[model samples]
Target: MTQRRRGDLLVIGGSEKKDSDEERAILRQAARKALEEDGGRIVVLTVASMEPEPLAEIYQKAFGRLGVRQMEVLDIRNREQAYEPANVEKLAGASVLFFTGGDQLRITSQMGGSPLLERIFALHEEGAAIVGTSAGAAAMSETMLIGGPTNRSCLSTLAMAPGLGLLKGVIVDSHFTERGRFARLMGAVAQNPHNLGIGIDEDTAVLVSENDEELTVLGSGAVYVIDGRGIRFTSLSERHPERILTVHDARVHVLGRGDRYNLKERRPIVPSLERV
Candidate 1:
């Protein structure tokens, strides 16, 4: 059997700095690095946003300032355009494919099984870098967090939908700390204990390297990992549908800038500096 080739993924939290914000430079720096490593051409997908044009322009200018020579915005509004051969061809020769923040459902619903999405997966298999922000980030996992209440209660708080499936065994939530979404993520994990839950704070990101299955935290904020694999008990299924849910012994880890985690191992990899 042939082994499947995997591409790098940069899952950014919401509110990434576009203009001159030095404090949040890590997010853009990681993007620039991805571009430099692969072909310079970038294809920006704005299908998720309601106003694709403005979001496209914002990224165009921002990336232009970062010295990205070749870039184009593919604002695929409907299903007809999503499967267009001409539009799919635009993704050819592109080294980076970026999805901007908007409604995650727009991306999954419009382009879900389209030829354009197939082409993107092909390109990613061939080593193209894939980057997403906010809703885009949430849509990278196989199980997407569509909507949920950001409250302490876990009962019926999360609504899930299918995602792009770029990253498996994980569900990503953005604007984590800013929106106080820890409870929301816990609710998601409670429903689907098989997958890991990753909550990323605003202006933060996690760079997942396909080669080693390791994730490196970047930017100013933190990344929270919720592992429900060790859960000894749960009231999710037994509790009343309208009642609050509960779980015991769900392992949690907090990673700041420069911290790294091994996805396959499900543990933090100590930094070299710490050992020295």
Candidate 2:
């Protein structure tokens, strides 16, 4: 057998809340599908510094119901247990690790560049998987957006902050379509037109790995991809640095399952592996 290739990363948006029983069923299937492709086990580490009770409970149930042999949430908020040896061991063996949504800055500030973060990166390097949603997902990029209700609500300009930079060249913004995060991501795109902007919608995820290879999509919502290379931006040239900035000329691709999304070519990257 080919030594199972891993280090695959998934970032997601929120799930749709509906009266229909089919809603969560679809989301759960999407979650399971994404997780099963790499490894069927998971260890969810809730280090985003968010409101933990409900999100943790919901995830625990979801992953467990997916029939994963082991599913857990490692609470690193407690200073006493933050560096505990037992915690480290649990994380080391996890096939998929999740970071809950909360504050992106807090997540990166607390965990980034640390031994635990190092271990997670190493696990990803060794072919284990990693996934995060909302704030959790946003913090994984090179240039993360730390503060924002968004440009719509704020009068001046959308705030952009430094990110953990785990997935370089790929800047992510969660809660895409539902909350209208495209403009904010576009602002970031303006900063680095060469980088790819991935705006993950509610109940959706974008899967990326090393290699200018395959990038896949999972879940109920759409993924907005903004490719700025070879495009002209008349607005970025303006000195006001305020309202009415436009990156009018870049190509944007929206992908769902069975569609290809490439990381290198910066468009609808194709899938290298057959769908399981």
- Candidate 2, residues 32-96: lDDT per residue as tens digits? 53466555566777777566777778777765665555666787775445556777777756767
State how far residue 210 of model 1 sits from its true place (Å). 3.7
Per lDDT, the best of the predicted structures is 1
Evaluated against the true structure, the overall lDDT of model 1 is 0.85
At residue 185, candidate 2 shows an lDDT of 75
Error of 1 at 59 (Å): 0.7
For each candidate, C-alpha RMSD in Å? 2.7, 4.2
**What TM-score, computed on C-alpha atoms, does each candidate reach?**
0.93, 0.82
Q: What local lDDT does model 2 show for residue 84?
A: 67
For model 1, how does the per-residue alpha-carbon lDDT over 1-276 read when each residue is reduced to its tens digit? Answer: 966566678899979877675774744654564457645788889999998888888888888777777888899899999888999999887778899999999999999999999999898887777899998899998999988776455675468899999988899999998988898898888777889999999889999885638999988899999999988877775447687777888999999988999999899887798544
Clashing residue pairs in candidate 1 are: none
Model 2: lDDT equals 0.70
Displacement of residue 126 (Cα, Å) in model 1 is: 0.6
Candidate 1, residue 105: lDDT: 94
